[model samples]
Target: MRILLISVNRERMPYPVAPLGLAYIAGALKAGGHDVRAIDLCFSTDIEHDLTRIVEDFPPDAIGISLRNLDNLTYPSSLSYLPELEETVAIVRRRTPVPLVIGGSGFSLAPLPLMRRVDLDFGVVGEGEGSIVELVGRLEQGASAQGIPGVLIKGEDGFIPPLPLASFHAPDRSVLDNERYLKEGGMANLQTKRGCPFDCIYCTYPLLEGKKCRMRGVGEVVQELKVLQAEHGADYIYFVDDIFNYPADYTAALCDEMIAQEAVVKWTSFVNPRFLTTALCALMAKAGCQGLELGIDTGSAKMLRAYGKGFDKEDVARAARYCQEAGLPLAVYLLLGGPGEDDATLQESFALMDRLNPTAIIVMVGIRIYPDTALQKIAVQEGLIARADDLLEPRFYISPLIGSERLIETITEAAMKRQGWIVPGLEINISVPLMEGMRKFGLRGPLWELAGRMRRPRMRPLR
Candidate 1:
């Protein structure tokens, strides 16, 4: 069976993402003896032409489109590229009659309605490796897709039973042999584990990955790092796990293995605030971990409870202090507006930010409601949404009790008073001329180009 996987993520944020999910699925299918190829729309200039050519050349038996994100996942708005995705789907459909399956970070979060809108034959609810392989096998065997686990069919009477998550070794990077992309500012991403133990209600990770956190062996992780460093010349890595420090001992062991193997690649990962301790921080730093991103979503205890963030306010502060004392650069991520978040709670968040003063703080001020997540339930119950099934126009941002715009204003005002605090990229109100100038030149282009004149460096006057 020949499988063609399409990654429908084109917008690149400040961070570097390598579309590991799609690559993992391709690896699994190939491992199962099925021919597979991946078409990434992120770097592709002409998606339609490229996809058409691939279909004509490869003539895949099944097509899987990985929806990496719901329009960059920026708060206050869910970006929609439905028309573009639909067009790709149409092109694929027209060129070949292969089965179309949609799965990825975004589809994992909102599978049902996204499937309805995109006109995919089916979609995997969560996790693509096992489900994708099974789907391909069933289709190959000419078996009815009726009882396939983790798969959804159009007009199906009920939801498909979720498949038990599969535990596999670190992905075979050899599947996508070219490692040059890693050296070109892309983080060699690795997921050492899946799922989050902490019940952060606002998060979609726990819901998507399930409550039970499954991990790959520490030795396997070390081996992958060694391969990346040696074969790929990967110097920077980003662990995209839900919580890098979930099992502190396991994390420490992995760090030790990396150190033992001389895998001295600079790395960064998100760690749960409550679980991280001084020892853990020290171990990470010694293992070449350059930075730590902590999910200190809020400082108010009430807001924390509302969002089901298992950790308390003190836990965040302690974790921040520990990371700081351990000489690790800290980046704190916070959500500004959501249920039970009021002016006072928002103020407390800022106060805590001022007190902790981590290396940087990122403020996210939008609520995206997925079907199964707690936020979606709350949205439906609060009349913010009509039904969970009506995912056609994904709606988010519940500021009715306080007003979403007002919330943004307050957060912006508070953020402006502080240094090293970053807001959502989409929300930033840059001048149109400046944005046009950025388009003329690359992101790292000289400011003098946009300034309309280059002031040559002048030798300082002799004093």
Candidate 2:
């Protein structure tokens, strides 16, 4: 079987993320004895021409399209990728009569709505690696893919819950242009684990990957890092894990393995504030972790509980202090304007950040609500959205008390006063050209340190 996997993510704002999920699916297909080829539309200048050329040249038996994101997730300036995905699907449908399958984190989040919108033969929910291989095998046999786990038939009522994989497959980097990602994006990405045990209200990670953390073998992770460093010429790696620090024993062992194997790759990951410790931070730093991106969300005690964050303000500050003491640059992300957000909670967040003084503070005003999330339920209860809403189009949860306008204004005012504060919703601190120039100058990792160094004009208070 010849499988053509296409990644339709073209958002290159902060940085272009290589389609690691698509690469994993391609690897699984190859391991199943199928000829797999991939097309990354991230850097494609002419999508129609590229799709035509690839279809005519390879002429695949099955086509799999990976949708990375539903939207930019930035409120006020939110951009949807559905149009591009629809266009790509239309082009492929015109080019080939083969079966069109859609999967990836974006598609997995709302498979039913997406399957209805896009003309696709199948949709794989949750993880694609195992399900894709099974679906392909069933297709090859000309059998009904009815019972396959995670495989959703077009116009189906409901999807089968994705079965847990016994083991994970290594991603096939050779299937895509990895060097370009490393050069253009400044870092290669790999996953140390799947699943998120945290219960954040606005997060879809647990739905996409089960709540239980399924860690990759530490040795396997280290080897992939060495390969990324050696073969791909990637000096930096970003662990695309939900929470890299959770299950502290596993993190410690992974770091120990990386050190023992001399992986020598500078890395960063989304660290959880609740689980981080001084010892773990030091171990991570010793294992060549260049920085940490803490998803602290908010610093107010009330907002923390409202957001269903397990960590409190003290934990956040402790996490920041530990990272700083370990000599690791820390980037903190705050998702303001959730359910109970107001002037007091917002000020608490700013005050806490001022005290902790992280390397960078990336602030997003509104919470992008997705279906099947706690936030979705809250939105429905509050009459923000109907219960039957599929939420295919981007809808955000801004507190009715504060409203979007005042929320943005308050954050923008506070961000302008702080040196390291970055409000992406208002486009205050970061820009694409600036990031490109920094990457061109050989900067790597999250590059939050450099972003923190950029100056912001302080604005006077409105009387």
Which candidate number has the best TM-score? Answer: 2
Root-mean-square deviation of every model = 6.0, 2.2
Residue 212 lDDT in candidate 1: 84
Give candidate 2 regions above 4 Å deviation.
457-463
Q: Could you tell me every candidate's TM-score relative to the true structure?
A: 0.89, 0.97
CA displacement after TM-score superposition, residue 297 of candidate 2 (Å): 0.6
Pairs with backbone N, CA or C atoms under 3 Å apart (clashes), candidate 1: 76-366, 399-403
Local accuracy of candidate 2 as per-residue lDDT tens digits, 230-324: 78899888888888888889999999998898886788898888888999999999998998999978989999999888878888888888988
lDDT of 1 by residue, 214-327 (tens): 889888888888887788777778888888998888899899998898886788888889889999899899998887888877888888888888888899989988998889
Question: Each candidate's lDDT (Cα)?
Answer: 0.73, 0.88
